[model samples]
Target: MFTNNFNNFILNTDSYKTSHWLQYPPNTEYVSSYIEARGGNNSFENVLFFGLQAYIKEYLSKPITQSDIDEAKTIFSAHGVPFNEAGWQRLIDKHQGYLPLRIQAVPEGMVIPTGQVLCQVVNTDPEFFWLTSYIETSLLRAIWYPSTVASLSYYCKQLIKAGLEKSADNLDSLPFKLHDFGARGVSSYESSALGGLAHLVNFLGTDTLSAIVAGNRWYGMSEEMSAFSIPAAEHSTMTAWGREYEADAYANMLSQFGEAGKTFAVVSDSYDLWKAIDNIWGGELKEQVKNTGGTLVIRPDSGDPIKVVREALQRLAAKFGTTLNTKGYKILPSYIRLIQGDGINPTSIQKILDAVTSAGFSTENITFGMGGGLLQQINRDTLGWAMKTSSARVDGYWRDVYKDPITSVSKRSKRGRLALVHHQGSYMTVREDELAEQNNILQDVFLNGELLIDDDLTTIRERTKH
Candidate 1:
């Protein structure tokens, strides 16, 4: 959906950012900035770090060319904005079109608490002092989107793990419990690629295929950490048979993909969900579902999440029968299960689980598919993400800088060159100058347009595992 111009870092910032090169102090030589989640509105204490490497590999790794500079010049002039013509020429002439900057960040997939630094940027060359903040538009966006998605996905895992511990047998199904059904619901292809990979960090089930490509291309992953999805029928596939042949549509799904030990899903909400669950699936397809030697997941697409899920589980339990686990919670027989893909979020998921488990059913008897809630339900303010120049060098003098307005104390930002360290088993953002550099947790991942570190999804997943 994008052209090669998408990789041009010169045109990646806001129009106002193009004028900021002229707004700095006359003697400015270097600048340092940091990014963190202030955690005001959302009240999330921790955020999962991700997607920076993908940005670095896709955009920053490439050199800015003459064509990029020409495009930026034309766009900035048309916007009535100041263009850094000489500065652009100098980058191409002196540094071979590479950015003269250094970026240090916490290792990807590690959960760092809000109000702590996750990334820091500094210019390697003093002449390019303004370059640090120039890329904030793209940089902050790159970090926030996937990090927020990963954090949300991570939070859901904690909730599911708690329910599984009390009512389910083992944690084997935890990864597949929350599947990614979010690709079509997001705003763009990049959103799907980024958000899908974030969800993959916590779960192994997904229908967003773009994430698989992103994993292999950006995160250095092969099929080892690839996501899985069962063949599932949507409303069109089911309703295309018309109400008269509704049973035939489900029967076709079993006939085609229902090999031994396989699982397939059919959305059974057309006409009447109860009739599809009771008269059709429970009666006509009962033997096929029971003796097919595989599992059939029943999907209910409409109605209130808690009530609909509880009623569906009860109906399926009565039809197929259930077995009690060691914890005395009833689990659906191995041949059949239920999935609620409609109106799903963490709040609704917990509510549905609470309702079903309260009715003596195990969370293992059902799975959840979250779409927009897992990807598009957030923004920069969701976790209070921001990037500010914490310190700057004026006339070769370095000084701490911060904003502490008397009106809003929550708008306060951190100051000085920062360093992240794990102290007493908890992460802390400290003064890099005051603390030992050897103890710093932030690694130099990018330098002068070169990617210094490459991480695979395997190590990333291990770091994020509960």
Candidate 2:
């Protein structure tokens, strides 16, 4: 809390972002930047536009304020960089403290093919061209990471649903197949909130409290329905009982939450995982678990996910027995299930499902918890996200602009104004002028100071249903 002039900057941005010259062209009278997910190493065929509206409302609505300009002037002058105080002041005076930028984006939750335009940014006023790309740089993290996480979460849901269809009688449990365990693994509270909320668009199970708060605040979700969590235990809780009292720890969990018909999770790997299942849970506490009228989720926190999950399920079934679902697959008893929380990503999740099903168990017996892989273990290139200026109005004439880096062919940028069109049940990128105005999927989400589109979380979730 102490005063430090050195720490005061105009805005919190990347370190390289301090140099303003790096953000814009020398002649930046009017620049148009188009942002897209170019489709890199992701397994999905399409990118989901999920979080742009929230970003626009929270961060981009008011681009620059008088205080921001004054701080920039002070910081830049002290650092011996040319600060455009006049340009910033002009924006504040003319735009009424809002950024004079038009943001056109595909509606949140709509699935658009890779290389299709997700959002486009253009300076509404000719004088603010240099500001467009700078704002894009500031806002890229808001769009790229959330959309990527949403797409990944959506695809993971599809995989889980498919596995459930083959193994379980129905897909009623798909929404809770993958739980968000990424809150602590993310870089910041804001990251956890954004990434957690993105995952919620496809499923509801989450331990990230900030995500629910974000949904209620930004995505128009009521406090009661935004997201949910269940009572769960960590390594500390189980290990705190000491090795000899481990069985008592398992018994205490069931005694607390089992009789009330409430579901809860307990980590089972603090000691010998197999012993906990065989001796403690399956032996001493078996009747308590069966009589609790609630589900006891056993979590395996460490080891090879596929092998550990399959082994844990086999041992649990041996002790608790199994029930044949309507689909003719073997499901565990209603009171017990397995949760694999370690080394769980999209790939490992599929692997675990396959191994468990191959071992004669239904997918319903298992749920997944992903931490870093769901949130922190990604970057802009994960889905090939890029924002490049596609058109610029120079000398009062609009001209197509693009970049074709010799270093990487895939880095080539598009030219002219862009549009996403529905073509043969798929979205396609095309020139804006080539499409009928009504057919263009890109809608004005933010124009000047106004938010044109604010989608609710429920509506966004409904769009993800296939």
Candidate 3:
């Protein structure tokens, strides 16, 4: 979605701008001044420069001139770090130029099956092969989490599609809103944001501001859709002693919202769930809500999710003076939905779908509040993420190799620069090491620090559109 002019920004890989983010204080001024100064003179260092270079060229496209470069030096000198010609020349010699990057995967939102090669990044330059190493953390985090979540999202989609096809009249009426409830469940802020965004691309909702920030910054999803909110309420413990406390809890939850017709989702499994639903919910409140057209979501925190949803829907229907739409034909209640939580994995989710369907509840009238399983269950190791650098020196050949104490096949790193060859629609990793003495035209993605890869998320999305 980035403009063509914006896509032309490229700073040489050796420029201080390239390593700005890696520095302790973050070299924002150097990067900003360099890009503003030498607009057309940008280039990337060795092969690992593809990602950030691509991002700048295809998105920022700021105009830079020699004056900007000199200004950057002035800024550095003012900061007690003198920047000079020799330093610039050393950077140019050591890191200027581009690293070819290759990433292969199923579509971002598509269900990826097991044993797939999620992605691989190979250095295009023999000299700067080490640069490829730093990219693994971010790239793996980016690709792996989404691929796994996409699989689960598709699974949930299938469950809804199947349930809708079974009983509902129009598929369009039931909008499945899958919310990410795992922000606090994960290990770090970065993982929480990225993982939430990945699932949102396939599913529907999230609560993380960081996720929304990333969606707007990277994928252009609007702030409105990304910034959804939910109310907070305190409840008693899941133990038996909470019976005396349950009434006050429900009253307090409703008190905060105050007689409004907005949706209220209360965790219902504390003390006897059936008593809460049958006595408290079904008696005075159900009648009040029925009069006011307010819907109640009985979030089950314990018991089998399949059993809980089945019974909950049955009770809701019975209260409404409606019958189960058996024989795969039924009318859906517009006001009510069976929202569920707790242990919603693929297996548990499948069970809930089946149980609700067998009990004659429209699966479309349900929202899943997924927690740790969706966010933390998927690890980077599952995606087969690897970064291999095959280099081609000034001499005309390539070699691709790696050393591992765990592997038997050439523990020593492969010698030479490598090129990626797409033969018969499959990737054949080729070497550019000097031993072969064969010349193959490399796809010049980076030269003098300019990035050639498409960095716009949509452009990258399109390239995967096979």
Candidate 4:
């Protein structure tokens, strides 16, 4: 079953509504018929989404086959959008066999750099030229959020590296463990899951249920840690409802699920964190954890994390009778780890890591949890992934017209389509928009009616790993 979080966004079989400046004319059969002719399966869901029903009405056909309906319905259901029986029939009638020119983008988790054409679409039929005008907005809607968040995760990895370098001394070892905990801040469940998957390229743990379901469905990773649920407040189960109880609960929880050679993180700022640690892990619980050989992760959710980490380490050393090397060097894997979560951004990470280095505790014992700085704070447009129309010509003149809000370029589009090629060792994004009349290395991805790019996410991820 699909998780409740992503169900609404993916299954939204509503009209392809957009927030762009361009719109197509009503019943413009030329475009609709063109899509229908070239293996385009149009449905009301697509039509409404495209928002071109009035323009494409002239090319409207009878109801599409159950197979087509089922395929779309399945896509929607998996995404968690409730089926809209009320408008299903109407959409089927309007978009049957009308495949809108769809661009098969690189899978969700692939880390694409700035200024790349994440995806693009055009009319399948020559007469349907007008349909291409509407693809930019929705395509970006699909591409931007995940790419941006993934990119943020990538940068965060750099901070982790920096922290490691600064604290090489006095630390045992540190694992690059990053977790996405920004679901509540995301605009929709779909975005949350996509963001989570994208982030996995750099950070593999997440706290969004939708991300777990969607990531496994698309990326073949169901067993991955997608969510971590432990409330900060104590409950009534003999564990009293306060900070002391919370700390004990954390140590006990880790002790209960003892996984040797693995790390289990506990939020330590539920009340007075040092007090909790002294009260719970200090006397007996700490020894139990040490004996079990499982590493404990103390998360600082409030206050100056760097200071907290220093004090926590000091207290641990005093209690355990093991002194921390104040200079540089690894402390060893058996020591506990520290994770910082509150208000962590790229800039803040540098600050905290620098502070921790000055105080002691090698960088190997620290990790970070990033949430808002990525999902809610960054603007997708700033990354600059756009699909522009470049022209190809029967004549020798080649032109590339790129649109910018501030200015228009003189390079006119050559007209036709675009395809990317692998030449030498680098990728050569070419314009099928016009054929060169010479043999080119790139293959036509969507030719006549079939899509040629391999749709598997794993294959793409592996191929681009260099």
Off by over 4 Å in 2: 1-29
Clashing residue pairs, candidate 2? none
For candidate 3, write residues 319-367 as lDDT tens digits.
6545344445433355445567688876777788777767666666677
Q: Give one clash count per candidate, in the order shown.
A: 0, 0, 41, 38
Model 3: ten consecutive residues of lowest lDDT: 30-39
- TM-score of model number 4: 0.65
lDDT of 4 by residue, 339-371 (tens): 777777877777777765665656665677777
Local accuracy by lDDT, each model: 0.90, 0.84, 0.49, 0.49
Put down candidate 1 lDDT per residue, 300-346, tens digits, no spaces: 98999899999999998888789999999999889889999999987
Which parts of model 3 have CA positions greater than 4 angstroms off?
Answer: 1-120, 124-126, 173-175, 227-229, 232-245, 251-261, 323-332, 388-395, 399-466
Candidate 1, overall lDDT?
0.90
Model 3 TM-score on a 0 to 1 scale: 0.63
Write down the TM-score of every candidate: 0.97, 0.94, 0.63, 0.65
lDDT of 2 by residue, 1-466 (tens): 2223332224546434456544655565788888999988767788888888778777765556666777776666676767667777887788766778888988889877788888999988878777676666656778999999999998888889999989888888889999999999999998999999999999989999999888988888744687778999988988899999998888888877786568999999997999999988899988888888889999998889899999999999999999888877888888899888899888998899899889989999999998999989989999999888899877777899998999999989999998888888787888887876648888898888789988889989888863
Candidate 1 ranges beyond 4 A from true positions:
1-6, 222-225
Candidate of highest lDDT: 1
